[model samples]
Target chain A: MSLPRHVIAPAIAVLAASGALLRRSRRRQRSRNPRPASTREWTRHPVGLVAGREIRQRLRSRSFSISVLITVVAVAAIIVIPSFHHTSALRVRVGVAPGTPSATSALITRDAHALGVVTTITSFPSVSALESALHRSVDLAVLSSQELLTYGGLGASGSSGSNFLTSLSLSLGQASALSAAHLSPSQLQTLQSAHPFRIVALHPPTPRRSVDPLALVGVIVMFMMVNQYAQWILLGVMEEKSSRVVEVLLSGLRPVEMIGGKVSGIGFVALLQGGLTIASALIASYAVGSPLVQTHASWTLAALILWFLLGYVFYSWVFAAVGSMVERIDQAQSLALPFSLPLFAGYIYSIFEASSTTVSTLYRALAYFPPTALFAMPTLVSRGDVGPLGFSVSVAIDLVTTVLVARLAAGIYRRAILHTGSRVRWGDVLRRGR
Target chain B: MPVLDISGLRRRFGDLVALDGLSFTVASGVVTGFLGPNGAGKTTTMRAIFGLVDLDEGDIRVDGHPVDAARRQRFGYMPEERGLYPTMKILDQVEYFGRLHGLSRADARSKGAEWLTRLGLEGREDAKVDELSHGNQQRVQLATALVHDPDILILDEPLSGLDPTGIDDIGAIIVERAREGRAVVFSSHQLDLVENLCDVVTIIDHGRVVAHGTVDELASAGQPRLTVRVEGDREGRWAASLPGVTVSEINGGEVRLVLEDHVDTDLVLSAARAAGRVTEFSLHRRRLSEVFRESLS
Candidate 1:
């Protein structure tokens, strides 16, 4: 599938940036100047080593591959299903009484076409026959040149059949009135154009009043991506600790480097899977010509990716720290609750608030909070409820909070990682023991 | 000069003092046996030397320089908790640890293979750690510790769970590393192995150094004893007649005697000769296990 120019251009820029970074690193590696070993150079070796291991392990795991496959299929189905339902033809059947003049049929067809509805007209021998035909074959019937009969239980309020009947009656009545006035064709045209009315509202229309389906998709994808990947990191850390592999790791590397490497490594995997899902959706939408995917495609996608990284970094550390405290998998469930509760709340709140015309006070507050910002800011931006200033403030809040949470989590992880056996309590870890 | 020197190291976990003024020096080209009873702080001392445990009141030096992260990278540590990633391949796991210790990727890979081959894990490089037997996994753990050819090696209870053959194999490896001029300090409860393999032994009890010397030096530190055998003294009834000699054991023609502090060796010899024609006579030193028990008490 072909990517639109907007998608391809950003992807190329990202590739170019990464290539430059790689070149710079290689040049540093090859530099001939004799320099004393710097701290960054020394630490980079172990951190890179650890991150490489994490990336390789997860990327090669069967579960990761299977999950990616399932997610791609699901995303493709989402993109393709809607186009099939909405893009088909809309036609209404109108049965005419057989003895009625052909001019009435002509009027019905003309008005139906003017209103953008396709029509199929059938002539019946009698009014009873026309009424009977409405039940079996026609959507509505024009009986004896005066009355309109609709099929019982077939036409609901705001249905195409009701709309077609209303347009047909108005067209017929207007033609009769014009004939009674003895207006020429040019006079009729002038009269029809003479009294066109314009409507005015006291309040201005809301910007982006229509709900963007892409943003709704973005919110759901972001919530699931962060929640799922954060748990992966948590379970991975606990497994290493429970299996005692962490002891060997800590002996050679500092706690911060190890946890940092793990977070980045798993974060990379999450991004990879997320990118695949998005690409699948884009390609599927392009293939089926779905208008939903084309609406604000570039900005919605970029926002989703940015918020995902921020959210993942914010939560993955908390999970990693908690993982270090628990000695077994069973203890992880309870410990993970407090960390995941806010994420769930934000997800539910965003889903309910994304479509509302007016933003709620709670939503505005949540948009500024780091944990919920991942859900809130993207929705508000997609809905045009947030301006540039608001978006910047939300991002700044998330970044600052991420730094603080990272520091706190690293401290706890370092203190409790080596304390094996029973689950370590937060009180004991914070107090002292190394 | 010693390769690793830990002096007056003090550490406490809450109110319990894990290491109290513990001091020792491990010189290159020798295996230093770190011996202590269960809670005697041998493990803690090893950890402190590697900079794993922060000392509340002491310092550690390597090669006449204060130990830092760079210097600590030159040392390898195997904790009492035997750890290996169960799902990781043996070769990859070993090389990963080697890289963590600051070896280049190519060097780590080659050295990892060499160590694995030396530890008799030659054909199982591709196998996951969980697939191996407990003894084999222990061997792999040692290979991981030694993969980078560390200048100093600290192994805690390195032979605790090893079978007879596994223990012998690892014992040979440890001695071989020492022969290559690497300072090796390992703690084990098997006094016999320590006595046979270590060039010097340090015994700690109650978090302090109680005894530190060669096996011969520690053994000789105890009271002098004599083992005497007389052809005609079946029950050694005549041995008790000695004024300053106390008979500790008598088995048929043999009599073991502990001499008083001021008693001369000639007096014990004369008493044995007087009782009956002396067939055997030798001065005896205590075994390491006996010395360990005495040191703790």
Candidate 2:
């Protein structure tokens, strides 16, 4: 903090005098007619200053430096490894009855391939063989009947055999009735040509797990990243408070500004890391030149970034304020334990929802809360549970939660930072009486 | 007008009366030393005045108005424990403080550099704060307090870790600030520095003001008793025999005698001459330290 005497002396003298002069002017006004001192005009918010300091300090630390490297590698691995994956496209296996060497089999084979399946057809002559074949069903199959003219689809369920069975029964009954009544030949021909529309489509209950795999990956990734970075905010605040440097800042600026600045600055850094991860994942994936990159992965990555911001804001204040309550760095983790509970729950729930393709009301409720929203919303978006309306609701809730929690945290910090004897009690902090 | 106007301040921490009716005033352009022993509420008092600590009773005003948002920005405070970010570069830390005190970015940066130079920390501006010697850290701390050009500086234990050179660095800067008409208040255990630097002092003990006002006023209140020694007076038993005199010490050709305050100086001198040639005479106006120690005890 020094310069040579020659340069510093003049500058000091000028500054010292000017500072004195400015002070005198303010004093002179009060002497003539005093105004209230606590007025808003006197406020010099410490937000930007403290935040900028925290950011610059943290950026220079070994942790942030190391974390940057880790984030890049992790992102690269996430994107590149997926692109190189070999077992992604879905396929199916099938079985065919023996002695069925015909063009009908070739047509069925062609249709199976078109339906995103790789099929294999084999013979099953005996009941045991047929049962084995049924167990290894190729999604659908053709079965031969005893009578040549009147045959039925067997073993395979639904329309596979229903229409054929209906036709066989009709032929048998028609033959018996013809023997009994000597019916007209024109009517019989009419029945044969009656309705050439014999299209039978089999419907199965929808697949139990049809949720997009891409959405699940994105939602899980985002939830984990946001949770990881919110802790960064917590740990950052704890560092500042424990070092007591924040006290020097508090003297000049209000706690709101201080906390706000810290959240913004470090939050910006966290946001950058989150964005970088997404970008790296995209770039590496694109560089790998996988065709599926844009089809689904891109949207999930974007949701992850947005979720990071909303989540950071909500949890940062809670963590930051909780930080001020305790004075030592050693106590930070324990103090942070309760605050991170909601976040942890959100992360776990999101993962469960993604894998099971089933959303929980608790997770949805957590989503509306600011701290967990960063995790839940992105998960929902990835799970296709979020649309325009749900997004609006979550965003609205996030904003409100941010404002309210910030205010609450600021109040606690302002009161507790200066009262340095012991950890502040939550009830005392919230109490109206000082 | 006084730059700081504090009156009727009373505060308590639970059952402990941390500040019992603490109040004083500081005018611009003079150094006011806040004097107190440990747990005497010196730090607490300063914090309360700066609006960092809430008060239980009475109001503290700056420039005749209550100290509040308007005036707090203009006040610079350095807490007693020497708080600073250990990892932050010297220049960055000071500049950050400047901004917190409301200096614009460019202004903070330039002023911060200028302050670093003035603090004799020019080359070390880029060095991390904790890496510097304790003395250098103290200088940086001072820079933080002064960087914003605060109208009023309330420093707690400003000279604790400073070397003689570092002490001079801060003392010179403070004297310079006071000369420029910015009110400066600092507390220190170093009695001589406070005696030399402060125009007015408030000595507190057990959360109560034991003494306040000028050095002269405190001295007078304690009394102006002088100890004199005469070469031939020997044990000064002869001086003790003198009217209105109590001898307290004797060595070689010297004798320590406490002359009554009401007694005339001429009489003591004449009595000393009668015993022998008076060699040494020292007048004591209750060394502030004595009062402080005795009060605390």
Candidate 3:
């Protein structure tokens, strides 16, 4: 960039006069009395010291307390609120009439078991009573050997009542046929216990998938954690720079050590907060009789925490570098936009994919990409859609990317931090590095 | 005495040359006043000494050994722009800096407290830096620099923005550090205060040392000055006809004449007498400010 003459002129004059003064000083025979020094050892673990300070400061800040409290409340509400509504287990009652076959009750019970619902059977005195009891006393009733009744149709054909009716009709017909054939007990037993053919196909149907509701919740939690903690690092670095404390710190510690310590410190606090939130969720679920407590919870939480760490470590360095470039809060916000875009994009896409039954190719592709993998891979893990190999590969990619990002961020941070007068330009810093 | 030698230092900020072949030596047990005009690289040089600025080409050494991180750790620095963590407690902030410089936690805390007390911030150690007045914050800033008990102190504009009491307090601390046999260097625009407080002054203009010597030596190096007042010479035009003497100041009937080395004081007196009956006449050595101006000019 070309500087105006107004700026260039004084600079030239200063340089010229400095050169002149240099000649003047050279002419004089100046004396040099060098100071003797002892080699004193420095703290070998400066990064740890820096990180330790960050941890203490963050813990003491009121914001950390507030954030943890808010997270607990939010996590508890997510686990507990679903148990309050229709999202919980459904209860069905079946009334059996006197004339119905003794096997009818067994069949209905078996059907309900297959559908993963709770059911209770009550024997009524007569068919009229069974009809009368429908809807009022029971959800369904067996009127006779071949007849059954419901107060209303059991939703669509795809619903529980239709399924129960189909299974019952098949069982009763087979019973009637065996009775008419007059088979011996052994023959009848052999016929009744015959196994159905195991259906295998060259081109199998796509596996059924519903969003693992818990995993969806986990993705949201992970997103919140990674985003919030990364921002904490950004704001923390900005505070040091804006307050001008960074210069003093950089004097005692290298820039890399300063930033490394900050990231590590904040990352530790983030994990602690994540653990607290997860614990609160589990406790809240248990207290509220929520089924989420039993549904592959340990593995789900472990995946969530692992991904949160990966996501945080990857993003924290970038935010720290951005923080060092700008001193004002507004400038930090603006400069942070480009980096935050990827975070927001990944979060939004993950939410969509987690909520959807069929994962798109884009979502699958994103699972392997480092930035979005935090969301995508965890979502797949939650739904049991991913294998161990897929998870490991995604994790490895993120780890490698994290290493690369840290080096780049450290470079930028070291270069930009000491330039104080105005916002340091990335181009200028990078150019200077070259 | 410990000595710091900065030789052949050069740094350019794009088109602006911040430091150009800047060199000087500072010895222990004396306050070296680093003087320069705005943009003359005083702060830049101070920063360079602490390795805050990456020199394009040069070396900074202490006792004929190159300064590295381990060496810089023992050097205390107070930048021209005062900075501290505003939300941090005064003592904790100081202790943090001390710990950064390799002090043990217990030592850092104790030394931080001691410095706070010494800087007149005894009761305010628990207060957040932002809660204090500007002068008190500056005190806290200085405490952070001193908590590590560094062997060399580089303070840039330490006296700026201080009240009379603040100035006196900080000035005394600077002198005390020197008396303790530490190599102390501070930069300020207050030449007169520098004259009184500093044992030696290194004057630089445009990133190079124009003068470096004891205050007395630099002050006495200027051509003699004659202050003459004539009874009726209100315009003070008496010395204008003299070939080698230049009137530096004129007020009412008095003029201060800056004489060239060849100028005779007797001729100056005769000119003042020609104008009017002389009311007062005296010759004195140049002030440090005059030497600073003369060297830069």
Q: Give per-residue lDDT, candidate 3, residue A211.
A: 65
Predicted candidate 2 versus true structure: per-residue lDDT over A89-195, tens digit per residue: 33434344554334434544555454433556555575346545554463334444322221223324444234333443445444445545655888767754666
Q: What CAPRI class is candidate 3?
A: acceptable
Q: Evaluated with DockQ, which candidate comes out highest? A: 1
Clash tally for model 2: 12
Tell how far residue A274 is off in model 1, in angstroms: 0.5
- Cα lDDT tens digits, model 3, B1-297, are 448998999999888988889988999999999999999998878777766777899989998988866777788989887789888888988988887777878899999999999989888888998899999988888988898888899998989889999999999999999999998999999988899899999998888889999988887776789888898887777678789988776766667789888988888788878888998999877778788888888
Worst lDDT 10-window in candidate 1 chain A: A1-10
Clashes of each: 0, 12, 2
Q: List the candidates' TM-scores in order.
A: 0.85, 0.73, 0.85
lDDT of 3: 0.80
Order of candidates by DockQ, top first? 1, 3, 2
Tens-digit lDDT track of model 1 for A1-434: 22233234433544565477457644654362122353237434666777788889999999899988988887788778887777343577888886554478788877777766788888877887877777679877877666777757335667665666677788777766776798888998897778767888889676547667777777877787798899988998898888887877777676776888888888889989998988888888789886657556677677678788889989998899999899777799999998899999999999888777778898999989998988987787676567666676677677668778987898888778778888898887786547
Which digits, one per residue and each the tens of the lDDT, describe model 1 over residues B1-297?
698888888999888999889888889999999999899898778766655566789878898888765666778888888889899999999989988887777888899999999888998999999999988989989988998889999899899888999899999999999999999999999999999889899999878999899888988886777888988777878778777777766767677776778899987788778887888999988678767877887
User: Local distance difference test, per candidate?
Assistant: 0.81, 0.68, 0.80
Where is model 3 chain A poorest over a 10-residue stretch in terms of lDDT?
A29-38
lDDT tens readout by residue for model 2, B219-272: 556445666777755677667667777654455755545556687877777777
